[model samples]
Target: MTQKNKMKKYGSLFMATALLTGALAGCNTDEDTSSSGGSGNSASGDVIKIGANLELSGGVASYGSSIGDGAKLAIEEINAAGGIDGKQLELITVDNKSENSEATTAAIRLAEKEQVVAMLAPATSGNALATVEIANKYKVPIVTGSGTAPNVTVNDNGSVNEFAFRTCFIDPFQGTVAANFATKDLGAKNVAIYADNASDYAKGLAASFKETVLANGGTVVAEEAYVAKDVDFKSTLTNIKGKNPDFVFIPGYYEEVGLIVKQARDLGIDVPLMGADGWDSPTLIDLAGAKALNNTYITNHYSSEDPDASIQKFVEAFKGKYKEAPNAFHALGYDSIYFIVDAIKRVDGDITGEAIQKQLAATKDLSLITGTFTVDEFHNPVKSATVLEFVDGKQQFNSKVNP
Candidate 1:
């Protein structure tokens, strides 16, 4: 072979090698590279996967359904307005069945199998608590909107769970609000407590309410406990009625609380009923009956009747979308998703579990559909609670308690 031909062949080979190397480097660039977990390209080339581990069916189905609906509204609006960094957001939902063990399994599926960047934890504090283990194990952040139990994000030793956060105020504040409203507004000097012993949320709120009732110089005449899914609260109601308390505070899910209220009223023991956000379900009115729901109040996250522009806009949007006013659970679910989207936007790239978690920790006074609040050091939102009264089977906005 000629010397010129040999040089040409070697040069051509070198150029080919350089071209291949450049192509490989290009693929590793920011636009082409994908992160691990469901947030990355494996889930969808141009969509961000967010896990919605919710109790879509079972005792708390009403709460879960409302929450999911609100989340759906927020997701649609966000996608319509150009999703985070131009990538559409996708929700990968799993039903926890309103059970703690199932919640843990759902979290595992979301974190390990689906590889979601973050999860909107179950609507209940009990379920959220169960899912926390998976969040920490997988290094993914999980935020709950309606989990009001203080320990939902705060550990028993007063430390914040790094991967856990919630949008709602803690039970201490909510319970205190209820106590004050009962004693100050209702002129109640004696109160009875009925709690869902099976639920961490109910137990936490009940304990806080008792503490506050004493602090406010009101006597807790009696206290009773009931398990979830227990339809019969007649005996408990009879015991509470016998106490002759001026009002009864039942911190439990709407499902059981509805029956409890109906039974309490049926026994001719009609005082006043107060509860936490758990009672903000439409089914509660249906189950308890409009007459039973009268003279009742609950500490809620948001009231659809709020005159605030943001609140009104959200309410209108939700009503337009679902053809029903958004409840506290719906607002909570909507706000939780925006929080996640905000964190993802702040990160700008590589939507991974670690990245989203870090950004979520740094969140500031983020305005949301529920309320405006900053995430405190303990990962609990520093927000206000709204006191709502049931009038003619509808929840009316009574007042707002700011932090």
Candidate 2:
């Protein structure tokens, strides 16, 4: 009846399903795709399954990999410390391949076939948006780590999506921070916007940036758009260069953002670039090179350079496990899983999605590796954002902006 015995009895089916699904999706087996490591248990079938639907492969795989690492670390620690009630945590992670359709499919598979009580949505807003519909339709609660676009959890009519929740600040706050920093601190008067037209995340941040820029007595000299997965950005950069804006604002994932930075620098555009949390990934530096990323800035959820005791502890633990410093996505993912587990404990080990959702709605002042914040009515976290400046290929802490 213990957790280990329950998993030994029931985990075969879960393992088989995961293997079959991974084969079909061509997912990486070596990664921490699943965790069921509880060794001893005293109750029967005391295993709590949670779904992780993320971009584990494809353009934004870096985000998925880092987030997965963070979540895996948290789950390991939770299970080691004795899981909620008597149940051990089992994370069944699936790769959405960084596509909206794949995210929807992954969510469905987790909810129906995998039978996860709750879901951790993808790191990107576009993918998270697709999962939102599936989560609501299947009555499953889905939480996101870094899907900051406003509409990720809030519907178009300004109503909250009852089953959708996120642990990061929304696009408005992020965009406004970038704009405020550019205008007030950097003193950029005219700005050019290069946005990913194919991504809701990019479009939402771009819209907010433009609005904030205009309101702050700045002019948008030019704005160009590109679709996701587009490797060719010379034409867009050339067009933006013609306008000669003081700063270029790109609110997209690191895969494309890194390319844009390199291409822009190649085109002799020396203006500073600013971006949102989507820019937080190791792939960015790998693709763009350290020198090209110099003078760039991003609004993020956490800074690795923070000297806070809790922040330092998390950094050390993450580095010890992953052999690399954790990024904003890692912090967000770590906090998100903790948030879900905390809610589960508050409900006295109720593994039902409904009960967990109710507790998530009431989350307040929960201290996390990222920061302490409460869930607002729209299911968005009201937390502070750190503006990080990339200098010599390293992210240095800048100013902190509160929402």
The best candidate by lDDT is 2
Per-residue CA lDDT of model 2 for 1-403, tens digit only, reads 8999988877898898988998967643332132212111112277888899998998788888788889999999899999987689999999999888999999988976787878899988888999987777666789999888889888899999988999889988888999999999999999999998988778888988899999999999998999878999999799999998999999988888889999999999998999988888777999999999999999999899988899999999999998988898888889889999988888754457777888899999999988899999999988899999999889999988888
Q: Candidate 1: what lDDT? A: 0.86
Per-residue lDDT of candidate 1, residues 335-357 (tens digit): 99999889888885566777787
Candidate 1 has what TM-score? Answer: 0.87
Model 2, position 197, has a per-residue lDDT of 91
For all predicted structures, in order, the TM-scores are: 0.87, 0.87
* Poorly placed runs, candidate 1 (over 4 Å): 1-44
Lowest lDDT sum, 10 consecutive residues, model 2, at 34-43
In candidate 2 the C-alpha lDDT for residue 374 amounts to 97
